[model samples]
Target: MPVILPTSIINILSNLFCILINISLFYLYTFKIFYSFQENEISISLQIIGIIVNFQEILLRFFVGYYDKGEIIQDKQLILLNTLNFNFFYDLFYLATLILSQIIMYNQKNSSNLVVYFLNLIYFLKAISVNKILNKVDQLLYITAKADYIYQLLKLIFKLIIICHIVAVAWHLLAQIETNYFEKNNTWLHDLNLVDSQWYSRYIESFYWSTTTIIILAGPKGSNNIEIIFQSVIMFATMGTFAYTMNCIGVILDEQNRKQKEYKRDLEIINIYMRKNNLKKSLQQKVSNFLEYLYQEKGDIQVNKNSIEVLNKLPQNLKDDINVEINSKIIQKFKLISTNFSQKIIQEVIPFIQEECFLPNEIIYKHYQYDNLAIYWISKGKVQIEHQQENAKIVLVKVLEKGDCFSEYQFFTGKQHEYQTRSADFTTIYKIQRDKFIQTIQKYADDYEYFNMIKDQLIFRNGSIYTNIQCLICKSRYHRENECEQIHINKNKQLTILKHLRNQIQISRKPFFRKCFYFIKTIQLIKSCELCVNQIKNNQELFNLIKYIDINNNSMDLDQSLSDNYIQDKVIKNRDNSNSSLSSTSIENNVNDICKQTLKNFKNSIIINSEQINSNDNFKHSQGNKNQLEIKKELQNINLLTCIIFINIQIKRQTDQQLKKQAQIQIRIQKKQIFKNQSIQKKKKKFLQKKNLKQENPQKKYNYLFKIKQTKKNTQVIITQQKKKLVI
Candidate 1:
C-alpha cells in the first residue's frame, strides 16, 4: 500500500524545502569564497558577489520577470502571483524564524518551558502573518505590471526594500563582530549585560539595535568618543534613508489619491452632462451601468469627456504631444493602423481621436443601418463584432480585446458597415472619424491619385466588386457616382509627360532617339489604361479632342483628311523648287507615302492621345463641390505658378536660338554676295587688260590706264544697278 500525505502538509514541506535549499546554497557559496581566498580577499569578494547578485537578480526580474531564464514557461492561462522581492523577504524571514526558534528552545533554562512554548507559538503566528502580507503584495504586483511605468516603479520599491533589509543584516553582523572583539579581551568598554551568550541571541539583539538606528529611533549607547562619532554618522545616514523612503511612499500614495479623485470627478460631470442634455432614460441608464462596470473592472472609473474636449481645443502640436505620450502605444498595437501607416502619420492622427466609453451589451452600430464612418480603438475591456443576417439574427463574428480596433475596414474602404459592434464589457475606445481621417491623410499623401489608390486597395480587400461600371469619359469606372477629381489631375500629368516625351525626341541625340521613342510609346500605353482614360475624359482641357479624332486598335486616325491635304500642298511646293518635271499625280502619291510613314512613326503617340478623347460627352455628376473646387484651385494655382516660371525660361531659350539662326543666315548671305561681286569685278578687269594688251602691241594696244578706267566705270555701273534693284 502506498502512503499519501495531505495536500496542505505537502505544500508546507515543499516551502520548507525551498527555504532550506536557499540557505544551503548560500552557505556553500560563502564557504567556497572563504576557502579559496585570504581573509581580506574573502571579505571584498563576498561584498562584490553580493552586490552583483542583488543587481543581477533585480535586472533579471525587471526584464525577464525571473532570476532564472530557463525556468520560465509560457502558459496562456497561468497567472503569476509572486513578486521579485518576495523571495528575498521569504528567505530572510525563514532564517530569522529558525534562529529564533532554536534560541527559544535552547535558552529555556532561564525561563519556564511553558513560556518558551508560548513564545514559539507566537513566533510561528507572526511568521504566518508576515507571509500573508507578502502574498497580498504579490497580488498587487500582478495588477501594477499591466502599466509599464507603474510596474517599473513597483519593481524599484521592491529592490529598495531588499537593499534596506540587506543593510540591516550587515549592520547586525558588524555589531556582533564589534561586541565579540571587545568582550573576548575583557575590556571595560564591553558591556556583558547588553551582549547575549549565544551567537544567534547576540545577532538578534544587534538586529533590534540596527532596526532602531535605521528608523532614526533610539539606538544602543556608545562607550567612547570614537564610538559616539561613528554612531552619529550612522544616525545621520539612517535619518536620510528614512526620509527618502517616506517621501517615496508619500508620493505614490498622493498619486493614487489624485487619480481616484479625478475618476470620481469625471463620473459626476458625466451625470451632469446627461441631465443637461435630457437624454433618454435608457441612454442614461446605460451610462450609469457603464460607470458601475468600469469601477468593477478597473477598480476605478476614468470618464474624461471634458478633458478630451479641452485637449481638442488646444494647439495641434501640443495636443499631438499629449495624446502620443498617453495613447501612442494603445493606438499602435492595432493591426490595421500599425501595418498600413507610419509612426509620423500615427502621431498626426492621435490628436483627432476622441475617447469614448460604452456600456456592456451597448450597441455601437447596427449592420446596414449606418455607413462606414468612424474607427474605434479599444484601450480597455472588450467588444464583440456581430454580423446580422438578413433574417435579423445576429452572429458573433469576432471578440476584440484591448488594443484591437473595430470598424477599421470601413474607415479604410468608405464602404457601408457590414457588421454591428457591441461592448462585451465596460469599454473605452479612441474614435477617429472618417472625414477627419481623410483630411489628416491628405496632408501627408503625395497626391489625390495616391490617396485614391489606398482607397481602392481598401475597397478591394473588403470584397467590393467594381467591374461592369462604365465611365464614359475616362472609359474606366462609374465616375458619375464616384466623382473623382483626381482623374482630371492624373490626365493632366499624362499629357505633361507626353509633351515632355516629344521635346526629348526632338532634342535628344540620334543614339538616344530610339530610347526616347520607346519611352513615349510606353507612356502612351500607360495612358490608355482605365485611370488615365477617365482622367482625359473628365478633364475640361483634355475633352476637346474627341470632336475630330478617331483611334483604332492598329491605326491612329486623327483628322486624317486634313493632314493628307496639308502633306500634299507641302510636297507640291518642294517639287516646284527642285523637280519641275514632277507630275501632280506623282506629287500626291509621294505625299501620301510620306504621310503614311510619318503616321506609322507617331502611330503609338496619336492613338494614346486620341484614346484619351474617344468619348465626346461630359459627366454631369458633382458632389462636395466646395472641397473639390478648393483642391482644384490649389492645384491650379500651383500649376499656373510653375507654368509661368517654365514658360518664361522656354521662351527665352527659343528667342536666343531664333536670333542666333537669323544672324548666321545673314552672315552667310553677305559672304556669298561679297564673293559674287569680287568675281564679277575680277572678270571685268581681266577683259579690259586683254583689250589694252592687244592695242599696245601694234597701235591696237590700248592705254592700260584707259582700259582700267573703263573697267572701273563698268564695275561702278554694275554696282549702281545692284543698289537700285535692292532699294526697289
Candidate 2:
C-alpha cells in the first residue's frame, strides 16, 4: 500500500528537518571551536555551490507566492511546489556544508549560540530538501501537490519546536558517543539515567539524556528485552515504509517520461507523413474532413511511438544526428528510402557522358599532352587530336557529342599516343586525371568497409561536362537581388523584398525580371508555386504584360485604370522623348484615349474582384489609374487598419475594466457613507435631547455615555500644529 499523507503531515516533516539543521549548528558551535569559513579550497567550493543555493532560494520564494517585492514581504507562507528545473544540486551542496560542520566540530573543540545556529541551519536545509524531493516525485505523477500553502506555513513554527527537542537529544547523544575522548568524562550525572524516572529533574542535562535514550535507544547490544525489540521494530518499520514509497515514485516518474517521449515522436511522424499525403487530398475535401475529424475522431487514437524497434538498430537521437547511417539502414532494409537531399546529391554526381560547346578553331588538347597514361572524354562538340610536327593535320577524333567516353584502351595499356587532342573547331571535354580517377573507385569512398567493389570500375574513367543549371524568365521576371541596390536604381524601398516594384516605379524603369526575382527571393520567401518567370520582349509588350498580371495575389481587388494626375506626370516626363510636345487639351485627350483602351481590357478580365475594391471607404478609387495604384492603396489600408484595431481593442478592454472597478468602488463608498450618516443622525438626536434636558434643569449626564470626538483620538495633531506654529 502507498503511504498516503496529507500536506499538513508533509509540512510538519519539512519544518522538523529545517530545525534539525539550525539546532545542530548552534550546538556544535557552543561545544566545539567557533566556526568560520576556511577561505581556501573548501570555502571557494562552497561559494560556487552557494550561487546555486541563492538561485534555489529565489525559486522557493517564487513558488511560495513571493513574486513581487510586496508579495515577498507579505509572504509568511511556505510551499513545496514543483516547478521548472529544481535546484537539486544547490540543496546537495547545502547538505554537504551542514554535514561537514557537524563532523569537524565532533573531531575538534565549542560556544552555545554558534552551535544552536549551526544546528538550526542544518535542520532547515534537510527539511526543505526532503520537501522538494517528495514534492517533485508526487507532481511527476500529475497529482495536485500545492494544497494550502499558508496553512503548511503556520505549521512550520511547530517544526522549530520539534527541532529544539531533537537537537538537545542529538547533543547529549554526541557527548555520550564520544565520552572516551572528552576531558570531563567523569561527571556523576553521565552514569545515571537521571530523567528516566524523574520528569521533575532540575538539570536540563537530564532532559537531553532522556530524549537521546528515546531517539537512539542504545543499550548493551547482546542483552535482549521486549522493550528493546519494540524500539527496533519501530525503526525497521520507518525504514521499510520510506523505501517502498520512493520505489513507487520512481516507477511512475519513469512511465510518465517514456509516454511523453513517445507522444512527441508520434506527433512528428504524423506531420511528416501527412504533409505529402495531405497535398493530394483536395483542399475543399481536406478542410471538410479535418473539421469532421476534429469533432469526431480526435480522441479515438492515442499517441504512439512513431519509430518502432522492429530492427534493433540505432536510437532516434543518433539516427537524427547522423542521417547517413539511418538512410543506409532504410535503403538496405526497405529496398528504397525517399530522402530529398540524397536524390539531389545523386543527380549532381551520377557518372554520365554529357554536353559541351565549342568556338571556332580552339584547341581541345595538344599532341604532346596525349600520353597513353590518361584518357580524354569527348563529351561534346568537335574534338581533334593534332600532330606536333610542322604543318601537321589536326585529325578529327571521333566527334563524340554525347554518350561518348574516349581512349579507355590506350589509357590503361600505357600505349604511345596514336593521335593528339585538339578541337576541329573549338571544343570542350571532361578530362579525368588518371591517378585521381583510380583513387575514387576505391569503395563508396565513404564506405570504407566496401573497398573491393570499386576496384574494377576505376579502370574505365567515365567523365562528362554538362551545362550548369540556370534560372529562366518565362512568366515571372528573373532578377538578381544584388542589382536591386544599384545607386542609379530606386532606393525608395529600403526593404526590397515585399515592396511591389511596379507600384514604386514604371514598368520600363523597374529592374528586369531576372534581377527582381533573385532580389526578392533573397529578401522574402517565394513559394515554388508562386514563381513563374516570363521574359520581356520590349517596352510595349513588357507594359502590357505587367498590366494584366494580378501578380500580387492580394491585388485582385483594384481599379485597373490610370489617374488624371499620373497621366499628366507621364505626359510631362515623356514630352521630350516624342517628336512633338502636346498642349494640355491634347494630353487630356490622349489620356482619355489611353484610359478607354486600358479600361476596356481591365473590365473584361475577372482578375480584379469586387470584394477588395470596396474594402476601404476612406480611400477613393478611380477608373483611369493603373492597377498598381489600387494594390498600393489596399496594402496601405491593411497596415493602418491592423494598427488601429490593435490599439482600439487594447485601450477599450482596459478602459471597460477600469470603469467597472471604479463603479464598484463608488457603490461601496456610498453604502458606507449612508450607514455612517444614519448612525450620526441617531447620535445627534440623543445629544440634542441631553442638551435640552440639561437646559431645563441642572446638568445630569452619565460619563460613559458622553461623546468622544474621533479627531481627538490622536494627540499627535496638536504636537504637529505646535511645531508648525513655532517654526512660523
lDDT of each candidate versus the true structure = 0.53, 0.41
TM-score, per-candidate, Cα-based: 0.30, 0.18
Report the C-alpha lDDT of model 2 over 628-665, residue by residue, as the tens digit: 55545444433443354345335534643554465456
Q: Quote the positional error of residue 448 for candidate 1 in Å.
A: 3.5
Residue-pair clash count for candidate 1: 7
Task: For residue 547, give model 1's deviation from the true position in Å.
Answer: 99
Q: What is the RMSD of candidate 2?
A: 40.9
Question: Cα deviation of 256 in candidate 2 (Å)?
Answer: 11
Give the number of the best model, judged by TM-score.
Answer: 1
Question: For every model in order, what is the number of clashing pairs?
Answer: 7, 63
**If candidate 1 were superposed on the true structure by all CA atoms, what would the RMSD be?**
35.0
Any idea what lDDT model 1 has?
0.53
